[model samples]
Target: MAGTTLGAASPALAQKKPEAAKPAPPKLSKPVMAVVMAVQKLQQAGDHAGALAKLTEAAAVPRAEKDDALILAKLKLFSAQTIKDNAKLEEGLTEAVEAPSITPDEKLMFSKFVAGLASNRKDYGKAWTWYEFYLGQKPDDVEITVQAASVAAALKQPARVYELLTKAIDLREAKNETGDRSWYEFRAQTAIDNKMDDKLLPSLLGWVKAFPEPKSYNLAIGLVKQRQGNLDNNVLVDFGRLMSAAGAMTDANNYLEYADAALDRGMPNEAEIVLKEGIAKQLLDGSKQNIKEFVAQAASKNAESKAGLAALEKDAKTSPRLALVVADTFANLKQYDKAITWYKTLVGNAMIDQDTVNLRLAFALKNSGDAAGAKAALANVKAGPRAIIAKFMDVVIGDAA
Candidate 1:
């Protein structure tokens, strides 16, 4: 390394002077400055009433043509807070903030009051606008973020509603939250409201896993029927069966439609089963001519198959697997006598999950009018998640025979 002489240093090698300081923010006009100082003094003196009154007086001063807008905006919030007069606060702050003079921070501060006052008045569209502006300054505030989105929804902006709701759910996910049940319900409800024709099934397919309130599931099945595309009736029957497994096939129309779809698909056996469930529940709407004729046809078909099912019953007693399978089918078909008999044979089997089998047995017995037998069957489901379900059934089964 070479040594440098201090007296003759090159220009580039010279020691640097200290950098200039940043320019200060522009000063307010004299009148605005005076009002600001006066307000500060009043505040220090605990004269909030005086400070507000003075600022209210200074709004008429003309020197602060440039800064007046922002100054007045802030003054409105101060005065309103001290007086607790929300109407004037929102009115004044709203006028001042719309001027170009307001800073990002000032907008966030006063806009909250404006939004709140608007919301209290049920002026949701105006509230949504202010909240949307507030979001620019405090983008990560979850509470405000969701409130903005909700107001957007109330204003009939369904797309914005979903967009913000998803954003909130994503924010929760970032913090390792799996999403609250209410959040999922909100999402599902949004889809339902929009009649989200194409997106309905895919949206609901995951929703019920987290929050399985029956309303959403019911809407989901309705959407499924609406969304069946050009698939054959076989596919519709399969769809109905899938909903049954998901507990979405609850309504009277669902039962009747499932039977019709099955029959149209050349699936007489499936049609027979579904119609039996509908008839037993009186959901075939016997007062309707079409329903009456359809029920008569399905009952006749089921009667023709009665001998075949009886032959299988003999084998059902020898093969417990067959009994369990037949029991599930009969239970679904509402043949409680046959289902009870077969389910009892499988209730004590080591080859099956007996608790699960007993839940089915209890279901058959409950429908069979032997409520006591159903309770006894529930007693066998003493462990696992099924135990709570069995306990629920036990309480509702009513008056054991």
Candidate 2:
């Protein structure tokens, strides 16, 4: 048996001869390089489709290793964004995040991108996760933390939102950074929503101290005061103190907001008094420029007697430019006939620039149970770019006339 095996091996060795090694596959060819360059150029130019096509062609080439990975990743990212496909965007971002060669900065960028896409798609849970991951890498990013807090608030996790925003505020305060009051405002608002009014007041006061130049703080303070049944001289004095430190423009807006809040809280008489005082002091001079005209019109609409309406009519006629206010006041009072009358006058006189007056008149007429009159009014409004109004009138007339 050993002699037979030796004879067989000798025959096999004699039959085979050693061959020279084949030349290694050639490196990236010029066509492959051109395709890669084209992909890069297209990517830079924001022509994602062209970039993707070139990348696909280049990927088919032999031995395109490192460049293939980069181009593929970029193509995926661009494709997701170009088509507004959030699922694809998140998938691509996840792949990029997991890539072994991706740098820390690139990974951070991918995480943010995924979070933003998730937010735009209203997938707050996914967004929160990605934002948390990004924040883990950049714990000092107050803006990102604030954004996370906002998303959490939208998700109805108020406690989490408060925690995150408090941290962000602390970080910002320590850094002596300013601007962007949205986080502070949101935190305060969330506190109000969560029934933590006591907590809200202190935070709002702190914001006012930190950003004394903004009247928004004063307005917020006034709201709290009013909510606590303190909208009196004391509230005004506090506002005056706040105004002394705020910009003039902001101070004026704060007064206006205070009045508005008073009106909202069923204290219209107080609002009127405050508005009168503001006007008298010239703090709200810019705002009051047209308010007298509005007040006269409102008084006219609310008059019990025709004699009173006549007096208001006389005032409105004296200031024909106040027709819009007169129309709005009448509309608010549910005096549709009177509103239609004023709106028509406005339309006839070209006092209102937009077709809104005609559309409003139509609505008023309809609400007053005069569908035919509304259609007629719309027909008379032949001008003022409101073909849509005409079309709407046709529909209304077809249905109810």
Candidate 3:
């Protein structure tokens, strides 16, 4: 638009009217000029095929001048557009954008046009090239960046997609702008799809934080557990607890795994509760022998343990290990107030790991929806691996609240 024009007839001059200004015409060689005129006449005559033939002939003519090359590129671009030839369209647009006479705006427009065109045709390599070009020139354009990320995904470049989206999302966050939810969804989905272990949790966290709901919470907590290999039962129990608190325990695996974790932690009452809920929700097959046996075992153990709770509580006063087990059982069973009481009793005990006890207290407090108390408890977790875990839990509690 800025550097080239079709040889349309001049508008008739009105009496005593001044002429409207026009952009300078692109320079063309005499041989190319003659061909362009012929091609223009054929185009005006509605003979597109004939016009394309003339343009092809002109393409073979020697063009020693840069201006001639620019003019030929414009002619090819016009011909490509007229016939809707996608391949030629990209080629022409690419050539035109590289010309010295092209304006910045024109270059940007061409870049986007070719990128979209190529993507629509499933020409991912070309689309990615143009998308990168456009993004390099307009790094802050979140919309374009997302399109580029999509193209990157089409090209099977997961890391590149992650990189592009992270930059775009970070840019928006930096500017305090939030509108599109897909940005975070795409990031999380990409990481999940690719099994990017390092990035999966953070991406899901971003998604759940932006759109906190049962489904998002379920996905985030579930995927993090799925992707992270060999997590401790304690960690699995915490994840299950978080999902349960958020009303996100929707999957059969989630129920079974949660129950298994609680059972492993010696909290059969909690395991029974989880398994019973799963059966009630029809998420677990109660007719199956394994499921039936697991449920029956948990129930029996829970009943026996419940009958012994009084004696255990009496013994817990003198043993931090017993106190922690009782506290954890209460936490797993969602009796968080009782759990908090038991956990607090062991917080300052000289014989116990303060960090571990305090961290457990924080989890109990958080499960009870006392986010402030949870954070206060987390502060007592001073150092060691438990402290590191506590810091992450602090973030989780804050987000859940």
Candidate 4:
């Protein structure tokens, strides 16, 4: 490398020139100064009222007009602090909001002060207005957004609360941040109360999928059952399956709906099974009158199946499938003896799933007034997903007994 003489004149390497001395701050005009001195004297004497009066007098001075905005705001702020009156603080804030020389920090203080004052006074509408203004300056502030949502809710503005809370949750999600579970609940209840029927289920389902919480799942499934079940049988079954699997199907209405849907789909066997299980859990009626509405068409089915079951009995001597039909139909119809006999025959002699047949026989024997036989049949069902249910049923039935 060649030796180079670097010149100091080069702009890139040159030292910066010394800065000039700052100018003195502008002085208040004579009348303004006089009023300020008077206010200061009153404040020193702890006569805040007198100081505020002096400040009010200064406001009318035509000469103080140029700086009057800041002067008036400062007076109000001092009075607010002295009297500990948020209303005075809010007055100062309202004036300060229009002051050109107010710092961003001061403006933020003003906004928060006014919002707190309004909130404390239970003037939620006005609080929402101030908070909206503040949050408008900081759209991504999740905490503030949630606070605004609470204020909106207090104001009985369900739609607004829903919007703000969901926004807060979404912002948190975008940042991959965890959120308050209550936020999810707030949005859900808001959506429901606001008659946001379209948004309610989707929001709850989102909560369930996102959080996988049991309470959220229950609310989501309950909303689905209460609001959308009447739309179609498929909706009922599809949603009921998820609800039941999640153990969120605690409501009798939900059990009734699941059975009702199965029945409407011409799945009487499934419906009958669901109803029996629900009744066993005391989630549905065990009495004939109590279950009357649910099995309205069953009497007609029983009469029709009578001939078919007779035919199945005749053919069952040759076909195990026919025997299974008799077993399933009679089991569904509460003809437990026949169902147990057929189910037991299949469990031992047929080339079918013995565990499945054993499970069916357990239910049949239990319903046929044979607790011992049911226990014996259930004991044979060892190791499978169905075993979990068998174990649960055993414990539950044992508890009841």
Which structure among the candidates has the greatest lDDT?
A: 3
lDDT of 4: 0.66
After TM-score superposition, what is the CA distance of residue 46 in candidate 4 from its true location, in Å?
Answer: 3.9
Predictions ranked by lDDT, top down?
A: 3, 4, 1, 2
Candidate 2 Cα outliers beyond 4 Å, as residue runs:
1-71, 78-90, 226-401
Alpha carbon lDDT at 58, candidate 1: 79
Candidate 3, residues 1-401, lDDT tens digits: the string is 01112122311110113438865666767887787788778878877767767777766787755567666666666666666665666667777777776667677767777777678777878877887788788888777788888888887899998998888888888887763688788888888788787797678767766666778877766665554568788667766766676678888988999999988878898899999999999999999999999999898888887788889889988888998888887776678899999988887888877877887788788878889999998889886445545545665677767
**TM-score of model 1 (CA atoms):** 0.52
TM-scores, each model vs. reference = 0.52, 0.43, 0.76, 0.56
**How does model 3 fare in lDDT?**
0.75
Counted clashes in each candidate structure = 1, 0, 0, 0
Best-fitting candidate, measured by TM-score?
3
Which tens-of-lDDT digit does each residue in 1-401 have in candidate 1?
01111121212111123449863454577777777888878877878678767876876777456665666556555555555655655666686668576656556665765676677677887887788887777777666667776677677887777777667767876896656655556766787789765444445554554445456556655655564456566345545654554456667878877788866744456677677676677756667888778877866765655546677677777887767757765765677897888787776688877876887787778777887887898898876435544543454454223
For model 3, give the 10-residue run with minimal summed lDDT. Answer: 6-15
User: Taking the tens digit of each residue's C-alpha lDDT, what string does model 4 give over 274-364?
Assistant: 7777888887777868596566564445456665778779899777767776786777677887788788788876466666677667767
Stretches of candidate 4 above 4 Å error? 1-26, 47-50, 53-59, 62-68, 119-132, 149-162, 189-198, 209-215, 229-235, 263-401
Per-residue lDDT over 144-209 for candidate 2, one digit per residue giving the tens place of the 0 to 100 score = 787788678768998888788888888877877753677677778888889886577566655654
Reference-based TM-score, model 2: 0.43
lDDT of 1: 0.64
Predictions in order: lDDT: 0.64, 0.59, 0.75, 0.66
